[model samples]
Target chain A: SQTIHQWPATLVQPVGSPLSLECTVEGTSNPNLYWYRQAAGRGLQLLFYSVGIGQISSEVPQNLSASRPQDRQFILSSKKLLLSDSGFYLCAWSPRAGATNEKLFFGSGTQLSVL
Target chain B: GESVGLHLPTLSVQEGDNSIINCAYSNSASDYFIWYKQESGKGPQFIIDIRSNMDKRQGQRVTVLLNKTVKHLSLQIAATQPGDSAVYFCAENIAQRGSNYKLTFGKGTLLTVNP
Candidate 1:
């Protein structure tokens, strides 16, 4: 069985501070990874996705970025965080084959509060 | 510019009753759909999915119905229980250029099953 792990279940960061959130998957290789953010009472917004190492695609212009350092390790980072960057960040993965219509498995998520 | 939207923001039902959640989408090019359940402070979990070629699919006690003619989708839960209380979201997969695809999610409907 495949499982995803996300760190820092809850985070409190000051404005203009650097941020890093890590996610990793086990039991799978070369899977598609994605990062999403959900604001309070709002729907999810896709931040970035990677089909392979060093192949990140941004869905929207934002203050954050994502990287795939290894086959199953993905990281979300920001050089300087803003108050508007506060939200619940999620990491998800899907099988690379026939990924266009595959369902995604998600991690527990990281709730970041920027004050 | 296309997006997914829900018909209701909240629903309350008695335990052991059936529950139905509705969603609407504006993108006709979407070929895949999914339903997800999210508890507070946790990531969304996949509940069910259906493709454009299929009108309905069933899993466990849940059913997903896709009406491509009206671009409407629905999720039905039989004998809803208190554990079924959560936010339900519908997502659509739109094919992008090349082999890329993107999922657009709806603002979730909060379901509360009373015991």
Candidate 2:
């Protein structure tokens, strides 16, 4: 079974501060990973998705960036946080081309509060 | 003009009643569709998926119907329960092998099951 872990589970940061959220997938290598944000009582907004290490495609251009340092590790970062960035952050992984391909399995998620 | 959309912003159904959430897509090139459920403060979870070749697919307690001609999709849940309360989103993917596999999601419909 594959599992994804995202942390810190919750974070409180002042506006304009740097932000870094980490997501790692266990039991799967070279899996496609994605970053999504969900505002309170809202749907998921795609931030970025990575097909391989150092390769990323952003869906919505915002005050955020993503990187894949290792096959199973993905990171979401920002030089400065904005109040609008406050939301629930999710990390999801899906099997690459040879595997299942379409079903995305998500992590528990991280609650970000940019006060 | 290629897009997926929901009919309602929210739907409240009584427990044990049938629930039908509707979605419309405009892209004829899209051959795969999916339904996801996002609970409060959590990530979107995969519910069901249907391909263009099939009009309907059934899973545990849930069924997904697809209409290629009109480019519409719907999810039917039998015996709605409180646990089913969540925001549901419908997404579509283009049909092709080695396709980066990006899913365009609808705004979403909130489902509130009253017990």
Candidate 3:
């Protein structure tokens, strides 16, 4: 079985601080990786996705950025965090083959609180 | 712009009752749809999915129905339980350039099951 691990499970960052969240998948290789954020009582927003190492597509312009440093390792980073950057961040992956109809499997998620 | 939206923001149901969550999308070219469930502070879990070629798909106790004619999708839970309390989101897969695709999510509907 495949599993995704994300950390820290919860984070508290001051405004204008740097941010880095790591996510990695086990038991799968060359999977499609994605980063999504959800505001409290709101929906999930796609931030970035990657098809392979060093390849990332940004879904929206924001204060955050994502990078795929390895085949199964993805990182979300921010040089300077904003108050609005606080939210629950999630990492997900889907099979690369027959990707059109594939469902995404998500990690436990990381909750970031900016103060 | 094209997006997915939900009909209700919240719903409350008694335990053992059936629950239905509705979603509508504006993009006619979307060919794939998915349902996800998210508990508080956790990543959204894949519940079920349906493609444009199929109108309905069933999982353990969940069912997803897609109506391409009206661009509406629904998720039905049989004998809803307290453990089923969570936010439900509907997502549509929009094809981008070439074989790439993006999953667009709707504002989730919070479902509360009372014991």
Per-candidate TM equals: 0.96, 0.93, 0.95
lDDT of 1 by residue, A1-115 (tens): 9999999899999999999999999999889899999999888888999989999999999999999999999999999999999999999988885546888889999999999
Displacement of residue B74 (Cα, Å) in model 3 is 0.8
Total clashing pairs for each candidate: 0, 0, 0
Candidate 3 lDDT over residue span B1-115, tens digit each = 4399999999999999999999999989899999999988888888998999999999999999999899999999999999999999999997666455678899999999999
Fnat of each candidate: 0.71, 0.44, 0.67
Model 2 Cα lDDT, one tens digit per residue, A25-96: 999877889998877766677889998999999987799999999999999999999999999999998878
Model 3 CA deviation exceeding 4 Å by range: B97-99
Candidate 3, position B66, lDDT: 90
The per-model lDDT (C-alpha) reads 0.93, 0.88, 0.91
> B13-107 in candidate 1: lDDT tens per residue?
99999999999999898999999999998999999999999999999999999999999999999999999999999999977665556688999
TM-score of chain A of each: 0.97, 0.96, 0.97
Rank by DockQ, descending? 1, 3, 2
> Model 1, residue B40: displacement in angstroms?
0.9
TM-score of chain B of each: 0.96, 0.94, 0.96
- lDDT: worst 10-residue window of model 3 chain A: A95-104
Residue B72, candidate 3: alpha-carbon lDDT: 94
